[model samples]
Target chain A: MNLMSAISVALLALRVNLLRSVLAMLGIIIGVSAVIAMVSVTEGAKRAMEERIASFGANLLVIRPGSSAFGGRRGGAGTATFLTDADVEAIRSEIPGIVAVSGEMSGSQPMVVAGENWTTNVQGVHSDYFEARDWFVESGRAFTPAEVRSGARVIMIGQTVATELFGAAGPLGQTVRVGAVPMEVIGIMAPKGQSSWGSDQDDTVFAPITTARSRLFGYQFGVRDPVFTIYAEVAPGTNVSHAVADIEELLRVRRNIQPGAEDDFSVNNLAEFIRARNETETQLGVLLAAAAVISLLVGGIGIMNIMLVSVTERTREIGLRLAVGARRADVRNQFLIESVVLCVTGGIAGMAIGVAGAYGIGNLGDFPVSIHPAIAGIAIGAAVFVGLFFGFYPAHRASRLDPIEALRFE
Target chain B: MAAPLIECRDLTRVYRMGGGEVRALDGVSLTIDEGEYVAIMGASGSGKSTFMNLLGALDRPTSGSLKVAGEAIETMGPDQLAAFRNRTIGFVFQQFNLLARTSAEDNAALPLIYSGLKGAERRERARARLQQVGLGERMDHHPSQLSGGQQQRVAIARALVNNPRILLADEPTGALDSQTTVEVLGIFDRLNAEGITVILVTHEQDVADHARRQIVFRDGRIVEDRR
Candidate 1:
């Protein structure tokens, strides 16, 4: 018989045993749905991780002094600190890809404002700090370059510090007492939310580096000039490795480190860190996808099991058809068609359910998901494969049945 | 003279039952001409059913030659034999064997599907045969909705719809009442009268009596062939 007629006959047969057919295809249904949902969910997580990576400063590099990367250390990590503003200037002048650079002097300080006191982290920075951090004034203006040179009493308060210290009344132009010195809040920073490590990023205060050095913290205990770290933002579309090489060479020359002598600083590439995290996440996604495919395989086995039962149950019918005139090929094709129909139909249903389930997961949780159109084709292919794989043996058995015996079967 | 519609020469069938073999139809020979109505009768395991299966091309003989319409049945492959059966033979069963829940018309047209005829022609041919069997009005009725005799009539219609040269019935009326038996036998008689060769397998003397020729089998061989 032609394939079209065989398919129609198969459809008719499945419809006759509608409930049993559905039950038989249930494994394929769950498998396809799981695969689609799992893939979409993994993709969603990857994108979420990418977003967090971007927020974690994808283009920013942190330069820490006195790191263990310098070999022959006398004391600990802070023992070899010799970072200077002149070294920072040489980097700013020498590096081609550096868009912004800031010398940081950070300390946890107890501050009081209008009878309210809060202990908050405070960083001393350059005028370029806002751009380097991708932070902007949500309401007020930032400190000028002149303020850093003059050790200005101006400060920038983060959203958390602003809320905690001032509440409903805004903190702009308010006086905050640090130790015995008072500084005016010049800007309320745009909220930065949480860091990739889950720390509240919007809980710090910012002031001019010179002001931090002379007023509140005196000098960084182990580092020269009270500056402990430097932050650099690479220009967009520029290769960062070359910039790192140039900065390292320039810093080595400025610090008078000879060849074969280990340097006192470490330039940490944030992208490498994010890439490592992303690789781990992608590997996990692959694992999840494999599990989904396994379930689909299990579903195929279910189809095979049910198809065998169907052949056994309809032995007499098979005998009657053979007695009428159906060839063995015709019989085999009919059953194969039936098995394929069951899988393909179930696969389609699973795709619909999976797409809906994926989006539902996205909406119900923090993870975001997207449907890939290729999944439709993949699902159908998988269904056909499963149908053929699990169906062939049963169909062969049905076709091989002796008409005389089958017809005599009760 | 045209060739006999069916001819068998030393036809034998053996079944491998566990260790030893059972000679089901041992060294049997028979012939039936066109336009003849014949009945084969035997007790259970007397090989009458086995002979019918061989005649219907549903089983292969272990030895000797059996021919239908001059085509050797022994040498034909499975697919070729299936096609031969489709084109040359029509079969009826005791239980009607009509697919349940299918309308009488579709049941009658079942054989035509193998003939590769499209729906409209198959339905038309089936419709005419149903009418021929006096079941034209009940064409839409399912097997459950029809009486035993009517169901047998539908089976007759299905058997004749293919316009086969030979009509093989294996206890076609075995499940029916005496009244329905008479009604079904009448249709076979009428079809035989219309120049179609009819072969039936039965143990009932009265059922065998309807045929123009009767053959009796005992111990896997034909013991009697009489008019």
Candidate 2:
């Protein structure tokens, strides 16, 4: 039979029982929609991670004290007090790719401003900390070298602290009590929003390292000018891997570690963190893809079952067609085409549902969802494949039926 | 003299049932010329239906030479036989097997599907055949909307849409009442008068009387042939 008539007859057959046809298609629809929604969600997560990595500064590195082992008990990472101010100075002078270095010390304290009290984290660093972190003062200037050296009672407040301490008022030149010490606000730092870890970056105050050590957090005995973490920036056009290697070598040599012994510090590159996050997203994508595939497989099996039932129910119809000069191939094609049309229809509806579902999830959960056209195309192709792959057996059986026997069947 | 349209020489059809063979058509030989209205009369298990099946090319003879429309059908492959049947013969069943809910024109045009005819041409030919069967005014009506005789007329139109030289009816009026049976028999007589060969299979003597010739079967063999 010609292609047109074959399609028409198939459509007529499907329309004879519209409810059954739709029920048979439901599996495909759900499978395709799940795939689309899952892929879209993962794609959005990947995009969000990339943006966070970009915001965190590609050329930055964080140095922290390594885990310490004492008397068969191991402390967690960043528990040792091995980082000191001298190491920051040595790196600034000795490393080739070093652009800026800062020694950081942080602690939480209650501060009162205009009789409105709020407990916030206070971070202490040198003048170069702003440059290394790509932070800028929106209104006032940063602390000078003299202020950092003399442990001046001056500080910079982040946007969140500024708003809380003095709403709609100038925060500069205001006095805020930090624990028991009163300090003047020197500048208002620009907004940094939230970190990828969902911490509020703006809910902090910045002070000179010397002031924090002497007046707030007491120094560790026998460890001169100790700090918790050190932040650094690499010069542009410098390979970060080589820079990281150089920093690692410098710290290892200065810490007097034996050859083959574990180092007392850890050097972390932002790029490494970005790569790790991307790997995690890839793993998540794979898991979602597996789920989608399983759903599709189930849907394909449903199609096969329905097609078999249809073939058995229409044995007389098959007989009639065969007797009317319809080639066996024609009968097979008609049934196969019917299945494909059903799946294609389901695929289209599933796509619509998936996109809408993705949007709904994004809006409700405050995450992004990106529906890639390539993924959509693949989903539809997979649905069609499912139809053909599952429809073949029933169609083959129908084609091989004996006309005489089939006509004799009730 | 020209060859007969159908020539069967000692045709035999055997059915295998549980390690035994039952001969459905036992050494039956028959000849039918063009433009002859013939009735095949037999009781159940007399092999008249098997003869009709062989004539329609719906089955192969176990051993014998059976030729239809000057072609040896026993040697034709399944596909070739299907094409041959599509082009050379038409069938009307006792059930008046019109597809349900399909328009009369489309039902009549069913056989044309195998001919690879375009939709417009098939529908036009189907319309003309329906007019010939006195169903032109109800061409768009579905089979469910028509009477039993009207549905039979539609089936006849479908059988004739391919313009086959021979029309094969296997108890065409078996499902119809007496009045509708007469109406359908009148259509067969009219087509026969128009020089198209018509074959009818029935046990009713009145049905057989409508044909110009009659053949009776008993024990898989023809017992009588009368004109």
- How well is each residue in B134-181 modelled by candidate 2, as lDDT tens digits? 998999999999999999999999899999988999999999999999
Shift in Å, residue B157, candidate 1: 2.6
Q: What would the DockQ be for model 2? A: 0.54
DockQ for each of the predicted structures, in order? 0.53, 0.54
lDDT score, candidate 2, position A285: 72
Q: For model 1, what is the error of residue A349's alpha carbon versus the real structure, in angstroms, after optimal superposition?
A: 3.8
TM-score of chain B of each: 0.98, 0.99
Candidate with maximal TM-score? 2
The pairs that clash in candidate 2 are: none
Question: How well does candidate 1 score on lDDT at residue A40?
Answer: 87
C-alpha lDDT of all candidate models, in order: 0.86, 0.88
What are the models' TM-scores? 0.75, 0.78
Report the TM-score of the second chain of model 1 against its true counterpart: 0.98
Q: Which stretches in model 2 have alpha-carbon errors above 4 Å?
A: A2-4, A58-61, A66-193, A200-250, A269-291, A359-368
